[model samples]
Target chain A: MSQSTVPARGAARTSGTVRIVGAGLLGASIGHALTALGVDVVLSDTSPAQLRLAVDYGAGRPARGDDEPRLVVVAVPPDVVAQVIEQELADHPDAVVTDVASVKLEPLHALRARGVDLTHYIGSHPLAGRERGGAISARADIFIGRPWVVCRDAETSSADLAVVEGLALDLGATPLEMDPEEHDHSVALVSHVPQLVASLLAGRFVTAPEGSLRLAGPGVRDTTRIAASAPELWVQILGSNAEPVVEILDVLATDLAAVADALRHPDAPGARRTVADSIRRGNEGVERLPGKHGQNRRFAQIVVMVDDTPGQLGRLFGELGDLDVNVEDLRLEHSPGAQFGLAEISVVPSVVHGAVDGLTARGWKIASMPND
Target chain B: MSQSTVPARGAARTSGTVRIVGAGLLGASIGHALTALGVDVVLSDTSPAQLRLAVDYGAGRPARGDDEPRLVVVAVPPDVVAQVIEQELADHPDAVVTDVASVKLEPLHALRARGVDLTHYIGSHPLAGRERGGAISARADIFIGRPWVVCRDAETSSADLAVVEGLALDLGATPLEMDPEEHDHSVALVSHVPQLVASLLAGRFVTAPEGSLRLAGPGVRDTTRIAASAPELWVQILGSNAEPVVEILDVLATDLAAVADALRHPDAPGARRTVADSIRRGNEGVERLPGKHGQNRRFAQIVVMVDDTPGQLGRLFGELGDLDVNVEDLRLEHSPGAQFGLAEISVVPSVVHGAVDGLTARGWKIASMPND
Candidate 1:
């Protein structure tokens, strides 16, 4: 129900219909964005109920028999992506087809081995999603400001490439180009490998004593949060993106063994140094993370204490608003047993002193000084 | 600067001075809590400036030559905990002494090997802390609702055990009893090993290409957050609790290898099943975690879309207050480039429909359905 005020930028679409072959979250959301941009769109799916839900959500209407689509977007699970793309290309000979599967190279290889015409097909993946599925969770603004990588090869025509890039732009996303294999390896490093690691670490707690878990703090809670992600979906994602993920996990297992051995014989020569160096590398690794607006600049955080009651956070933010201190980011830390919560507000360095002074004057308790 | 309205819930202690041997975060915070409960607290540290800072913050006064302390708390680094406890026991022959080091067995063994009298000494660890250290980050309520594990042997006198438990209670902590070895193994499982795993995982990111790092999401971010913890401090913790942590890490390394091998050869016997079983085990592990108030009950979350401007979050929370929705927990998500943020408010299931309908009627955009 929210709207973006940023105007669309790109060459005019010159009137064409885009047909989407799936009615899941991504497909419906794509249709919603294209429809908003004045492009005639059609949605098709195997399940009539799912197709109707997407249509009712204003993604698109049922496909018309007489329609001639210029672009066919295949939005489906990774395992079926290659088969769906092959079929769509056959169904609409002139349309440039693209499949939004997470694993690009595997599907490309599948289609290539089947001897399909590769000139009109491109592989693309939008790095925006939710833990839940279905059209009910779909939103037109899900991809805004997110990266949508398009996989292009030598055979992809310039005109076809522009159409895909234009669609990404119209959906308020920044489209970047990468080869299929490169995209797979990048996501494996960032996404798939992390998922497996989180799962494996969380599995350790399954048989733990209740009393031991009573001592579980924020550190353990955070390090295992992603383990709650839907396993069925991840099974498919990991299965298709297997090779690169396996490679990363193998390397991580080796490092894990090294740390274990060092801890086992801490008195051995250079053992403590090995432990220290491993942790230091972690320090350097986290520092490479980009800050606000993709800049390397870090913001300072000011913590204020608030009671765990209605309107407490609202009143705190209101006081901050009166002081004209723009909060760049905010994190709330509280447990159900605690009677109060701490609101950590991030702001640029220049305004921190003023913000702290103003909040303290307003009777807000300062918990800690500005920290990175 | 804030005060807890919840009255202290322990037997009235009409007592003499309690001496604290360190003036850092934990030492000063314990002094602060005991002082609030009408206990005479004497503080001492090697650094005069640090001692004065703790005193200025009302944690305690400087120790006096004629003073007689009934209890002495040794709150120092893990590596020096044994030496500090020995010195404290020697100084206060008639007093009961406890060391608040993270690892328990190492210090106990060191004192036993040194032939120190064991009747008046207890090893304890309060599972409460902040990422930052020093008197500046000290809080009186840090121990509230947290587990304080007291390690007592057969030689520990009833009077000394009661005094230690009383100290834990006076600080608003739930005191649980365990042997030194059991306490060490428990913490190694819950705290120390997770720290190593997080650091090792984050260490991999140090040399990652910029493009691969760009794809990092909340999953990777949460799994590696504790990697930013102070490395020198953790090196000592892991070294002190080496046996259990190393044992767990070794087992985890084996499991990681199995998952990797399975992913590498999905067609091999039971390979796909192994991957799914590993993920399923993670789900079971997470389900074992207690929910709010240390109960197994789960709460439903109400997500409301908030605009990126000042006062938007305040307005939404203010509306929730008017509707009498008690927010159990809250999380905020937004990217710097996005025009809006989402506030995920957790509430009890019985009130979820009411909260959703009330917020929706008041013009709030619902992003997702209620989730645990």
Candidate 2:
């Protein structure tokens, strides 16, 4: 990835050599961004091939014997995170150590049980992940605009906490301070529970008749998209955050049973009300998600029908540019054998009027123009 | 919606006057497509406001008593669908009648219990729906490239089935023949069950701490997108098709409990295996979805980092046209305050190499290039 021309605020906040314990996706991405900020980064991993691949990709240089890192960031998977943090703290006595595991309390509890020194360790998690993992899929901008939670307690000094926070800042992530318990509970609700639910729902499709799947539309596809996740990885994440996840799923099961009971005897008193309340609660829940549904309201969409041939879209987009309309998002939909395709373009509401008028002036078929 | 310039195959397959019993989204959409094919269409609805809105939108004209329809299509909600179908059959004795309700068995069973003459009646479902309903959201192309299920019996004549199948073909839908029992069971797995699961999962988020939702990403968004559906509409759909839906949810609840038990005791023997199997089965189930993940496998993606400025996207799209590469699908992701946006463009696998090289040669920053 090329470095941006924008001025970076990273080098001022973070300095000296940094060591990354795992040369996987998160580790290599941190190295890429830090290296772009003109910082010295050293990366190491158990697999020699993976380490070499990350190093060869300019993530960092090979570890050297004389190198004294100011910070040691452990980016190992969940199962080994506690052990790695314990070892890193022992090896780098003078350095502040932080591990970016999803569940915070589990590893902290494991290290506490082992009687490891707690003064220099902080548990953190970046709420960012891709379907594909490893250095091959790593990008410097993976963490931009994502929430990275840093966990600290009475044992942590402000300076040590700053080191971890600075690392998050230099990588263009918003650092949110959360205690270990709060961090684990939050992720359990958002990430771990959703993963388990997707798996459970998609599992039902395994034995479904072929005719049932033939009727599959965008609705079912959207619900099961995350079901294609790596199974082994999810099992660890779910297991580590079991208490909070199980607590939520238990309540969700109660809801499921209530709906099922209502469906079984729809004529019973309050049966229809039970089913309606389930859906109404779901609507309120999704709307409660910050910044999720706001995206649709922030931008207005206009659909234009264009010929499937080349240059047709180019002309429409070019006209949009000439009108000074900045398209915030775009989705192009066309059936496999259909002769026409629809370009659903999302632009800011203020520019939508001008954008539609400009495209219409250029002889474009306005299939559905935004009025707002 | 404007009429397409391409020659239509609809006029030959579907001719004579057609009557639509509801003026909602599906009814108006069907009317729009039929009117475009040179067929005389008459529309009627229980509400005068709904009828006026659809008629004003050029879907069709107001119904007249002297007008005789060759085909009558009912597009009402599931609860009253059977009553409407029976009335339509009696009113238009010479016409073949079909209903676009999502459930097939419920209406057919209701009609049979009433001892209504079954010779002129055939049950059908389009397997199509949108989040919003009513005439305000109707579109002529809603049914294109979607599966439409038509159910017929020994009492039905070939001419009647032909009339119903012609409606599907004229609207660019693939009409598949299935018995009423098969249609009900198939929809229960694909459409009805998924809706319940989404609502159930999202319902858990209602009481979550706001911090949890701040970490929400595309994964949770995708799984819960369908949860925002209208509760009143879903209540009827689920109630009418309760038998098959309850059957599927029963087995899914068992799978859920097994995983929850394993998560509560992760260190126990076979506990991890239960969790792994849950995820593994989900992966297999999603892979079994025909033409879903196949969309990604059919093309290769190349992500280009473009500055968030006017004309930047236009220039890149223009360059794509110059290279003679057809963009099959696209997704543009940008953080709110990020300095740059990533345009993930999908082109057919055969042309990915050329598109990447061409863009890189033209001085664009190719953040990630397609190797497939």
Candidate 3:
């Protein structure tokens, strides 16, 4: 089992030679970052064209077989990830190996099924992405300020784990250690299940009358927002982590049926309770999230009406800056043909009075809306 | 049967005495808007306290029994909406009666079953509200540019239907006409089903490990944002439109079960296809909705790295305004424990190159990310 303290962040967080397998978005981005930090990076990919593109983009030099890398990172599609990890482990036997695949348990389970050596292998995932892919779209700072999860197994050495964490720290990502099972389950609950749910909800609108779609408000907008993600990428992710995802989906489906049944006979005994409980449970569930709802309770929200004109919002924000009020969060709300938008600015309660006074003095109209 | 085009836009969209039967959020808001337009508003409510509050807020004057209203609007809880509408029509036999209940079919059906007179009654719903309720949170501009749907029956006269449409136009809402059945089914697809789906997805997180919850990202955030709605209020809504909502939920549950089954056996024949179809259908469905992933196709997104400082976002937006590029939509993204956030601002494609050049020239870091 691995046991290591988190790396102490300093002027330099990563060191020695690092090898990155795959020259796609994640892999080349890692190469570009490490090379910028003065680390020797050897990049590899099955596609000569992609590898050459990465090298041309200064991500890293093409991988040379003779090179002895201290660490190896596999960043390939989820379907072929385990095979790639096995190849990297055998090719660079002395190097600490990690793969930046979204799913952790599947690859480890796949490798273990074949009894492949895993002493040097670790699994990690960074929760960062863009609308595009490939080396041409790669950027060094894409992983900055995102969660880089590192999963270590019983066979992973503490030194190897630290190397992985060090890489995360160097990229300005927050590193958190989790076992493979924990990592998979966590993502299933937060990422994979939510994706399917959004898809299911959005799919309902496909056959809806066009007029109904026009009545869509913030509620449906927020719920189905993620349904537009690419199916190919999601299929791989959902397939790799099918067991956990299916477990969540099965329960979710059952719950939906229960609510439907309750609605079908709302006057029956306990029918109303059943429907209420589903929504109440949802309230409790969402509250467990890190940034729970009722955020307005902690941060005072000053609802300011902004005109649809170009500089109006800019001027409002600029004035808030002048008042030295750091807006913790903000939400923009508008109707289909409304000329004005409402900007709900969340600031610390202590500064709210001053913010309101300052905004009013600046001739801003603040709308008062209280919770029932 | 009523046959009429929508009311024409005019300087004075409403005239004569208007009576609102309930002083709740929607009712008081209508009263406030009409009162401001120099129209006589007669407001009534079962709760004297609420009626007084609305009156004190200048929403409307107290309803006098002797006064004949030109139009009567019923705004109350969904469970009692039909009962109130029946009473309103009987009390003001000469006035055109409309109710702002969310579900139109249930109330209309309830009224028909009771053998109530229907000639002067038209059902309507304004798709406008706030997190809060009652006159305390009411505003004159709440309905501005929002959809106001009017449902007319075969017994409705053209003059009465126009009265209802005029009410919508007076409140600055665009009125659309549909039969009660169409309105109910549309809301079920766009609003009710989505609400339940969000609640169902969020309910799964009730027992999730804290660590997993920390990995929550935009997908989960967007999907579960509405799960915090009041359970009591939702129970009534779900019950009132149970037939339509249940129909949608049944199909959604069936779809969910199929995807779950596919994930359980991803390698089996046609399993991956099932999963892929679910997501593909989602893509098609969300495309039917007004926004997207389609938003991405329309607007070029410029992601700028912003320091978590007071003036960083303000400066970015101000600079965008200076470039004369109006940001169509925006998203602020950051990870826990990160010192900087990424502001993804969507701008019209025509202005993207110029906006990006301006931002880059102003020393803003724009990260390039491509679709995978």
Candidate 4:
């Protein structure tokens, strides 16, 4: 248990006062994390109520006229990011300006089009956020253990880039440098396209009969979980990173068409092979995902039935602790109409048998043991 | 806590010995539930080891020569369902034979093509299963409150249909009747296609650069989680339900192409509107999904971060109990390289503020509050 508490990295490396514009999830969360690390943070937002809520939640203090911020974090929406960055650069001459909006290329192009001095402005995106937005959903640790991509160009100074990386580190995130084009394309493949695909797939459920939805299983729920995200925000995101996203979507659409056509004519020559190949490609794709801690190793899962009553899960965890079996990951599944929960605990493969035996001995119902 | 221990509902309604072929997840789960209800259950499988394991898990006893079964459950792989159902029906002449295969139409068509007697056979699919298969993963309560779709034809007698529905009820499932075509089309829309789409999207991650997946977030994880399902099994399911699934996939493919082309030429007329319209459609689609207890009403979510320790979650849940707030649903998010877990608790909208305030007062870090 003690080993689980790894030391919080990035505090000592992060120094100086920072000012954040926009009291939304990213900006406010950065404020909270910096404040927790004893770094002086001043928060500024156009929405006074939002600013007040962020301050009340211990995110940061209101900006003061005398405060000389060494770094200005422009955590605004994607569409308005470039304008805000331009404005921030003009307002704070000495401070390095960095924006946390998802897309980087559009903002850089916009800033370049406006002929703004680009040396002091660094484009960075912390790959961390929740479905819901605003300061109310902000967490100091939201960026912890996430990758923060810093889009740096040749014109950007090393000192300015260092400051932005320090900011990401201070918020407990890893900073990786990438060219704007590469970053945009990477996010399109990994993040942007996945989001749109989820939304589009979930859209199929809209006109489905209510009875059809009653048969919706975990597969459908998980596939569309992110579809519940705000569409207005996503429209802006997909709009900004349209090129790379569309490029990937085009390939996916073509593949889908081919697969559909093949399935349409299964009796056709090579149709079954095509179908099998597509699914096999999917198998290869999912296998590429890094496991917990980026190890890419498989863990055995033990599904235990948990009664709805409180302390049942507590008791289960307590027993697991007593058994000295570390849980690598945990997922609690509860269907809409079900009264109980299914606690799927992922643990090291070596400890599975012992964990199962111990739990069964304790009268805990082991619903499923996949590795068995 | 006491109220949560609702009496198991299916025991009193279930009667007679049920014979289940294929001691896998669905079959073993059915056997377990019926056995718990004090109804006799006879288990069979080609694999002696699987049958022994299911019997050891108390799912049921081995088949006896003189024992008579009132119901015959043919639970096997989708590709083998038709043959298995034929065998079960032929073996148990007086029994009402039903199958729990995911696809209904293909098997019915295959059986018709084989000229198998159809009078005692009823096609049913219980919308309950796990990503992993086999008896070891089976849960007696897997079908509780989930919809069980029964496909009836003109040859099916009313008494045989009632027996199948009664079996569904005995397993605590809501039985819904649909024609074979309707069932196949609906599952394709709600189940089969989602599975294929998930696989295809996850496949995109395979060729992605190593650094790109480092930026993978919850969206990517949720979208691809179902792709981890056994590929060989999925190949069979998609193959068996190929026609309807192909029809749905064709339409989806067309939509993807349109969205892609519109994104490709964003400056073209109506491109942005096309993008926004697609996302808006997704919002409407996800909004149609039922919430807990099949209600469409929304619930407020409160994300509370708990230190990653053995009893941390237990303590938090215990506190929730003290506050007397019933958790409508719960999901735990734990990332690698992090020392804490985020418990996203869903509750009635009215209780959101109080729950947040109470947990905060108890020194829990409320990472996000949906309702503010």
List the global CA lDDT of all models.
0.79, 0.82, 0.81, 0.80
Which sections of candidate 2 miss by over 4 Å? A1-12, A305-315, A334-341, A348-367, A370-372, B1-12, B306-311, B336-340, B348-366, B370-372
Interface RMSD of 3: 5.2
Pick the lDDT winner: 2
Judge candidate 4 at residue A115 and give its lDDT.
Answer: 96
* Candidate 4 Cα misplacement greater than 4 A, ranges: A1-16, A46-58, A61-67, A155-158, A291-329, A345-372, B1-14, B47-67, B292-329, B345-371
In Å, candidate 4's interface RMSD is: 3.4
Candidate 3 chain B, poorest ten consecutive residues by summed lDDT: B1-10
- Computed on C-alpha atoms, the DockQ of candidate 4 is 0.43
| Models ranked on DockQ | 2, 3, 1, 4
lDDT of 3 by residue, B141-188 (tens): 677667899988788888888888888877767898888888888888
Compute the lDDT of residue B6 as modeled in candidate 4.
Answer: 22
lDDT of 1: 0.79
Per-residue lDDT of model 4, residues A174-239, tens digit only: 789988888898889888888888788888988888877777777787788787677777878888
Candidate closest to the true structure, highest DockQ: 2
Residue B298 displacement in candidate 3 (angstroms): 3.4
Q: How does candidate 4 score on lDDT?
A: 0.80
Candidate 1 docking DockQ: 0.44
Per-candidate chain B TM: 0.91, 0.94, 0.88, 0.91
True contacts kept of each: 0.54, 0.64, 0.69, 0.53
Summed over model 3, clashes come to 6
Model 4 C-alpha lDDT per residue in residues B1-372, reported as the tens digit of each score: 112222243444545778999999999999887887677899999899999999999889999887688889999888889999998888889999999998888899899999999999999999988776888888776776678999888988988999999888777677899988888888888788888888888888878898887788777877887777777777788888888888788878888888888877778999888878778887778777664323423767778877877557656766776676767567676665667767777777887888888888999877667634
